[model samples]
Target: MSLRRRILILVAVVCVLAGVAGLSFLRAADRAEQRGRTQAGGPEIARGGLSLTPGEDGPRIVFRNMAWGPNRDELASVPAAAPEGARTASGVSCLRFHSAGGTGICLQAVKGGVQDGYRAVVLDARLREVSAHRLAGIPTRARVSPGGLRVAWTVFVGGDSYAGTNFSTRTSVLDLGTGRLDASLEDFTILKDGKEFRNADVNFWGVTFVADERTFYATMATGGRTHLVRGNLAARSVTVLRENVECPSLSPDGKRLVFKKRVEGLPAEAPWRLHALDLTSGTETPLAEERSVDDQVVWRDDRTVVYSLPGDFGADLYAVPADGSGAPARLMASALAPAFLG
Candidate 1:
């Protein structure tokens, strides 16, 4: 071969080797970063293409009115703000629940891995959309404000998740009318992207607000620990109220709170029970000694608390009396998120 041709071939081989080595270094660096995430605890990095864009003025959230099933038939039903034996009929894909003031509540729909990327939609009587908007990726727990001015939810980006199986979840709030999202929740971590969590580390869920709009509460977990936090939004500060509890639902009067507490000897997937807390004194009382409690809860009145319990991939809604005297909670319907408008 000519000298020039041999030299050109040698240069090409060197460049190919360099490129492969560089790629290998990058892969190694990625693995090392993933490993570092295992011990890190801080606000999570936002992922997915969820937008928390700027928008118009905020609107009030009334209890939503909705009918289940397709168009007509007894199987189709509408819900009032308060539960007077409200039952979800079969063949229903989605139903609507109203807030106490009659404004419809907003449900954030999202994918399994990415909790923050959500579409907030209000369902009317026919399971039709009354209004809808997108939001920033926040692993939020929220409630309708007293004046119905806002749907108050906690904001946090999870620090860790089950690695690749988990997409990052963040927390933030939205203006009911304009659909503008403002994320100001304090430090929380989420899973490093592309990693799978063998178990859930912690993600924000469970949102309850007082009728007076004076307080908001939610649960946060990390490093195998769970905590219930009460936030004074007006003050822009938060206080850690307790540990090992979640899915808090406040009573109508805003004096009592209901939630699920992880039990000692129950399956990880379904090991929680209903409990109540007095906001005035921070004293907690068991509302149900059930084998386990469900995931979400809301007050039917000062006397009753309603929540979403996991049956499997899908979940069921149940109501338990705060007074602690009732038949093991009754099934309200085949829904995941439950709210009362009364």
Candidate 2:
């Protein structure tokens, strides 16, 4: 072919490719706009004053609102007695959140040039920033101690892991009272089977604190096995309690723990089954929910527990008997990371 003919063909190819790229960009933008629109039959959400301060309202519940529209992903609240009622959005957004004793731990993205940057922000009762710490990765789990004196969070750092994914976690604990931070739980002493354990691939996540504030529980993974470990803040140590336990949430009375357990023969996409563990008797009772739940559950009461499951609008809250008796019931739609307050 002549040189002029070849040049014309190349220009035609470039134009075709440009058109295809433009069409894809428009489609993506349209999808993003659709997400901002309110979906029919979804929960009602409106902007309003939200406070973590307890005892004013008659038992309210705060959560990350997963509902569609302008308030989506913001910290929201509704009366605990009527979780299905209209939500009041706080306008503060977080990827993961939890609160107790009038304080909140918000794991949120840092909006700006750095797209992947995130931070763990300590918030006051009125949702004001008390302090912020730069995070090294994507935020996953967050918790504030029962006394509100401590906060903990976990972020996903990329890597191929024993759990069969390119995922790893950095769990950190911060003393709100003293402003002291343990940047990674991996820094603490690990006691496994009555001996100090150390490994390069160890990862920790899903922290739950007891009433004493210093005592807590978290999931530790190493060598392809996960264990529930009792953590001591003062001593900076963790003792492995049992194997195959992940995301353990202590009962309100602190006598039992509701956790996710990996069941054999299940698909890797959804491998966990909720189970209640009796601390005194060392008994594990599988809950009635047959579907896999991948959440760190919260105790609604000593007898009941609440957790999130995948839903049309991201996630929904569900409740089940802590004793593994009654069937699971949907508590609220389009909500995640609930914290009950009086």
Best by TM-score: 2
Q: Give the Cα-based TM-score of candidate 1 against the true structure.
A: 0.57
The alpha-carbon deviation from the true structure for residue 330 of candidate 2, after best TM-score superposition, in angstroms, is 0.5
Tens digits of per-residue lDDT, candidate 1, 217-241, equal 7766556667787766556555666
The Cα local distance difference test for each model comes to 0.51, 0.89
Give me the displacement of residue 11 in model 2, in angstroms: 37
lDDT of 2 by residue, 208-303 (tens): 899998999999998888999999999999999989999889887889989999999998878889999999999999999999988889988889
RMSD of each: 17.9, 7.7
Residue-pair clash count for candidate 1:
48
